[model samples]
Target: MAETTNDTATLDCLIAGGGYVGLSVAVAVKHAAPHMNVLVVDAAPEDALSTDERASAIAAAASRMLGQLGLWEDMLKEAQPINEMIVTDSRTTDPVRPVFLTFGDVNEESNEPFAHMVPNKVLVGALRGKAKEVGVTILHGETVDDFITSDPTSEITLGSGKKLRTRLLIAADGVRSSLRDKAGIRTVHWDYDQMGLVTTVSHERPHHGRAEEHFLPGGPFATLPLPDKDGKHRSSLVWTEPTANAKRLMEAGDFTFELELESRFGHKLGEISVAGPRKAFPLGLTLARDFIRHRFALVGDAAHGIHPIAGQGLNLGFKDAAALAQTIVEADRLGLDIGMETVLERYQLWRRFDTVQMGLVTDMLNRLFSNDITPLRMVRSFGLGLVDRMPGIKKMFIDQAAGRAGTNPALLNGEAI
Candidate 1:
């Protein structure tokens, strides 16, 4: 319970943004250190999560973390395991798109699929429920208007005029985070000038849990398998295109849109029709110069935002949650200040390199594939084919994709902190 003094409540940690990363951090810390009081505040209304129709690719290690957090059993019912994945590079008008790479084997150690397609609503709902069970207090439709960090405590003023003091303040408030701006943290940012048009489609034939990524001149179009809904075969799509083209497509009529969609989606899954409302998100890369400061820290997209070319943005956010939670829990066990810069530095060092590497990799991939250069396409296709033929290399790639090939934190390894 938070200690109350006058009109202010004091907590061990106060997190901005009640999304998955923020909720996960609250649950992890409070679950491991039950004596601490954790709170999450989000600007969005409580009902916002229920209306999200998008989906994310949760890596194997992330699933393990979720299981250890005691939230996976219910989520597993709706999750769709990605049993296989194929990559192809072709034009939108190509008669046939030849596969350049294929992945089908499960993780060698865990025998788990590399990843799973989970609906955003299901994931957020599970996290919210678990956070509540772990005794993490949440404030909906509220924002942290401003905050002042002074050594042992950070005093925050909420949008509702409520005041709170916390030992640590964490920002998980999306890419354009106001809290981060208040902290005066600089970011290395760039816009891709592309928009990812996301929607769900019902198909005549089942996908059989196979994920596909087609790299065309505009960008990569990914069709990720989803569990059948009411006997309807379904898949979630992340169709990338230039900003102008994306706007045009989004404004197009249903018949016209489906015709264009079919040209790229092909008939492999039989006829496809939109089953959900379409949304477009602009693509960009934003990496914070620093992940932490005295009594403050950043997590999830608040720290870094990368292209979805590799489908690892959410997974990377999960990695931050695990690492930051582990760092805080361990520091508290030693009777040290969890918000101190010395302790937070451990997390920044642990995550910075990996985050920057992924950002650069995704940028390079987007630039390389989102074009029509003849020589470049041939080179990339050959590279993909070469990687596909090498079993050892392929296994390494799969392990990386599964989030098992690294110096992972305890939570990511499914171990309790």
Candidate 2:
């Protein structure tokens, strides 16, 4: 029930949901095609983006993309390089956990670490600043209530009664995207019956930029490095467990919670204590059936939501932003209709397979590790051990984690569209 208005000037691209993915799209598009008029709308208040305490792993290729957009320098100050990573498989109460696989500190050719850990606020704030500096119109505390797509243009109505006309409408509104739903885009979705417990921990010993992932009976438990806060060594922990157990842990007393954490985390980092408030997020896999429909396209979690066992969720979203921006900018530069079916189809073809592959891999990893079946556990452990014994296989995995194994778009490779 949108009030159609042709009086308003038409936008080149109208993006819904101004999170990291949405803002990155705005920055990438405007930076590439300065003449294109772009507008970003978010349902949350202006300060909401900077309020998140979570941190994420940024693969090297994604770091390059941020650098190209002039964000990496500012974010670099707060980023913690992940110099090494180790993987182990063990039961929750095991007195000793032996590492079955490990990745070294640097890429063979460039000597660059494969990834870095950065606080969510630092990255979001940097993108937001860049978006505004490039003249991308931002409508905070506003939501796209409805939109109608026609041959030449799409008209969107906001919650505040403002109407906008745009040639393309991009939905980056997360997994349960309202704009995506309104466009009649269907998704293949399912719950993992698990939840991820996230919080920071301060330790007596330095992590030295090393990350560890332990495959436990419940799920994968990761301890990712973070820059020390207030002179204390810190690490961000992603602990996955059964949904019921996750809830119980969240509600448990601090002492009880610490004991359970100590059992999985071990004593490698010396004494450890939870440094902040703990939060739990339900796990799931969701992939949209179609990435593009008419003048509307999906990006980020709106298009796909995968299990986070591989820590590639944010990186995948960044890939979507880069690819979509490149597709749109190239089409506009060629004097073609950017929202045409052919133009959008190219983007769908470029990204869909990689997204599906990652989704399947993460889903399989979660399934393979989140249990205690003796035979299956033995098989996976043997596989891990075999991979560790082969340097070539280890290098391949490091490259994959660095995001260098795929068919990447120019923007992701740090080039202009």
Note the clash tally of each candidate.
Answer: 0, 0
Candidate maximizing TM-score = 1
Q: Per-residue CA lDDT of candidate 1, range 152-244, in tens?
A: 788899887778899999999999999999999999999999999999999999999999999999999999999999889999999999999
Question: Per-residue lDDT for 32-73 in model 2, tens only?
Answer: 998888988888898885557778999988998999998998
TM-score of each: 0.98, 0.97
Relative to the true structure, candidate 1 reaches a TM of 0.98
Q: Score residue 255 of candidate 2 by CA lDDT.
A: 100
- The TM-score of predicted model 2 comes to 0.97
Instruction: Give candidate 1's error at residue 74 in angstroms.
Output: 1.3
lDDT of 1 at 47: 95
Global lDDT of model 2: 0.90
Worst 10 residues of 1 by lDDT: 1-10
